[model samples]
Target: MRTKGMQRSIEDFSRALEQGYAAVYRRNFVSVTYEYMGGYIEEITGYAPEELTPEMWDSLVLHVEQKGELSGLSKEECFRMNRSGQVDRWQADMQIRTRSGQTRWVSDMSTVLRDESGDCFGTLGVLQDITERKDAEKKMADLAETLCLRNREIEADLALAREVQHALVSGQLKQFPLDVMNEKVRANFSHRYIPASTLAGDFFEILPLSEHEVGIFFCDVIGHGVRAALLTTFLRGLIEELVPQGDDPGALLGKINRSLKEVFGQSDSLLFATACYLVLDVSTGMIQFSNAGHPAPLCLQPANQVVAKLESPDQTPEPALGIVEGYAYTTQKYCLTAGEALLLYTDGVFEAYDANNEIYGEERLMAFIKQHLDLASELLMDELLHDVRCFSTSEDFEDDVCLLAVVPTAVA
Candidate 1:
């Protein structure tokens, strides 16, 4: 393409300017000269046709290497000579401060002029302004940074809420009674507690204040969030404060009832909870228990034909703890032989439903317990939880689910 144009002898500079430099001179144009800048350059840079000096030309050329801004020269070579009579090529898109301290972005297209014979001649140039576009790009970048910061803040808040929920239920069943009988009687315990949101209303804990005694309870508060969590904490404190020193099932429930009545009355906010509190006396092999509106406890006696769900000595579902004041709570006294086992749980366990919406009901749980009968308490706990997860196909519980099991090494 260049060879054809060379043979044509470049009759009209306009054709050359239009073909090769149209984009550079879109605003305006003038023939190559040493003394004058093209109209396009003057219009874009807010500078007069003759005001571009030799210093401006040198600065414009050097500006290309200065990053974080724009600069350079064009092919026209119009403003190579300024009023000062100095000689050089002028660069464009160079930001410069005027006498009034206002900044202007200029697109310079200036270079040394030459005739058809290619003899050395003075310089020529063109210039245009580009400040508005640069400013807009910078503003967009700042907004993007601000949005990223906001997203990080939201993520951090979610993490904090999740931690709070885990803290509420984390250490519930930690200390089990390992040395219950003459020989070391061991029981393994495991659980799955997952809330759809940051915090759960479910809570579980093993109360081991002494060497031979343990008070364990599982409770589900009415709702989810900070409020529900606070209620669970309140109920936990009440039970811990009132649980008796002696291994008396009846007394323990009575004390819990009195405390709940003192704390909360019939409020509109469904402030209720289902709970099972038990006192296990390792030396006596006596398990004293009280259930307040909770699920029936299961006894897995391998020696027996089928797993048995212990009947509440009181036939009806007792009123939940915080509802009725001064109500009598009945106690059930049972004994576990050396090799028998007892499984205690909250409603969440059996109520867990799968995608098909089938509840992991009492019947299924009993069958699982019977199947894993000969296993030690620890392995049984693990198998039972694994089975529940398999049945539900998920860890999400319908309500607060807690499991506590006690097994003796040998039958008395």
Candidate 2:
């Protein structure tokens, strides 16, 4: 493997550089003429030294992966380099598929020879076997490509699944009833829902309990992604089936929970869900709501827009549904005057994180509500979501978020 520099004798240099086989290529007009190709010709290209120029080119070019550029030497340029006293030895790698259909990589080094009058005579070259190295290199390249392709396919499939989930998993189901039921013109409502990913574990819906009453329900499953999304879909159907009990928020949640336990309670995965349901009698300014392992809603006054956290009354304390079947859920009542409003939300809002890893905790949420209480429901919602977006480090949240604000119509 020793390499010789100019200081070495020509004999020593030749010995050092000699590798596998030698060949003499003569320039004959427009064609390459191989005057002498030694022992390695058959081993390397399955062609004899006496092979015709056109025949050799046709055979070798067939094996060359890049047929457009099969030449190893530019005879004219080599002669020019030699005449100019420049380093005339040239080295290159070639990709060839042998007659046996096996890929081979070989290194070639050639130097131009000159006649006494400084005219180009021919060229001498040595070809070395580098097939093992080439095979290793190709394998590495192929491995990298395969990995990249697999990753892209998985991401694409997940993206498609996400789109389907968004269409079916949200509270937009059975909307015709919600639209026409919201006829009590003055009840202003605004809400925001953002899933940490393409699909969410959170669900929400507005139901018209009666001609004079409307109900809103917000629910959050334990985790996220496909599993949680599936659970939400199940909950959606449960909500529709339990609409008959919607007049009493507590009764409705209890009924939904019992069905959930029957369906998912036996599973190893934590299938429990936290929920808050509210029914508002628009004409009477009466609002009744129930909570199950969910956050309490905030009640805001009319004139000064004071904020108050309507805590779960100890008398009607109940754990979140699914965890305790047959458990009685106590419904709480709060009277909203003409100018008052209520704010409902999921934990995703308070649990939002900043770059510093700090949670946008409940205290911050309470403060935000208190600060924006005087603003109309829709405006306050916009500002709240904007603030949350800025506070979070990225659009990819770690959880699902849902926020809703409801205000009764003002006195005529």
Candidate 3:
């Protein structure tokens, strides 16, 4: 019969059997023999503690390929290292087969036991069943690998889409050396496009309506990235279909607005875009333009040393596309002279925030244009973008930017 204290100790040890078993061993040089085994040893291995001989335990230590610190090491190596005093303790995640033929993972931890003389004797150790934890780790690893592969595939697709968008913009701009007003006037164009990410919502196209007339379409979707990029593509297709209406900027914008309304009606989320279209007759330097809640374009007059926004005649702005179906957009006119340049851009340009959280607003942009009026179209576009970036807190734009500079001159 056991005393109450001994019984309590036994019960406490038994309760620990929920996860693992503990054991003591006796050692003679490099050889080890079991001295005692307790706490669910039999329940875990399906073998009586008496039956678990040193040789049997060694046989159960299945050789497995492991990673990190345990790589290329085995139980035999661990014993040798312990005897040589190379290590104070040893730990390993090991696999073992039970009497029932079930393979299970276990965390084996042991410390070298020493006598009063500080001479090595044996080891005291614990073997905890960690099969569930190991299985969960494996599943997580597999999931991470799958996610990485999917991300790579997505990146590739986005790269292709970017290339396609670039090609489309390039194709539209190729209709250059545009002669108008009976071949007495020539039109030149320069542009810059930058995306905040792999894709952009800002898009522009130069349309050669006829020998004397050319059209410029600029738009900014509600946001950036994949969704906004898709909308830009859709808008590109709509622009192609609405080429007949392109002669009148207002009519073209009206048609685009109705088309966007029809498409957005099916979705619960609200989506919209700001756009501007302008038809320039190179011969007379007359621009017929319309706006769909977009930022007003700037006109630079080098002859007069003036810079100003091309606001509507009535100074009332129209709503953006995808809102207010059947709304009529009115076309406004502006006359350009020799040495004058028209600058069209998305809001990303002036919306940049500085380190002080102040916006590089339209006033600053107009001031920049006024100061750099003598620069060529290409140089101006590059300088404007550089200036905006310099003023930004992160030295980068948070939004996509698109700039189109149209300069018409007399063909002397």
Among the numbered candidates, top lDDT falls to 3
- As for lDDT, the candidate ahead, 1 or 2, is 2
lDDT of 2 by residue, 1-412 (tens): 1135422443343344444343333333223565434445456666554653534543553222221122444545544553353544555566656666766676666665555675555555666667787788889999989999998997888688677655544434332224555453646666777787766888777777776688888888888877887888888888888888789988889898899899988888778889999888877778788899888888887577577866566645568879897988887887777677788888888787888988888888778878877777778877877777689856655688877777667423
- lDDT string for model 1 (1-412, tens) is 1255542443243244434322132111122322333434444444554665545544444233222112233323323332223343444455666544466554555544454665444444434455676567668889889989987986787678668657656655543564545535434444556664555577766676466666767676766666776777787777677655536656676676677666676555657777777776666666777777777777777877457776575467787777777878787877776666677776666777888887888788888888888886667777887788888887665555556666544335
Cα-based TM-score, every candidate: 0.56, 0.66, 0.88
lDDT of each: 0.60, 0.69, 0.79
Cα lDDT of model 3 by residue, 309-409, tens digit: 88787789899999888999999998887778789999988999877889999899989988989998899889888898888846668899888888777
Enumerate residue pairs that collide in model 3: none
Residue pairs whose backbone atoms clash in candidate 2: none
Give the runs in model 3 whose Cα sits over 4 Å from its true position: 1-31, 63-76, 174-185
Q: Global CA lDDT of candidate 3, please?
A: 0.79
Off by over 4 Å in 2: 1-58, 63-97, 100-183, 223-227, 245-272, 315-328, 353-358, 389-398, 410-412
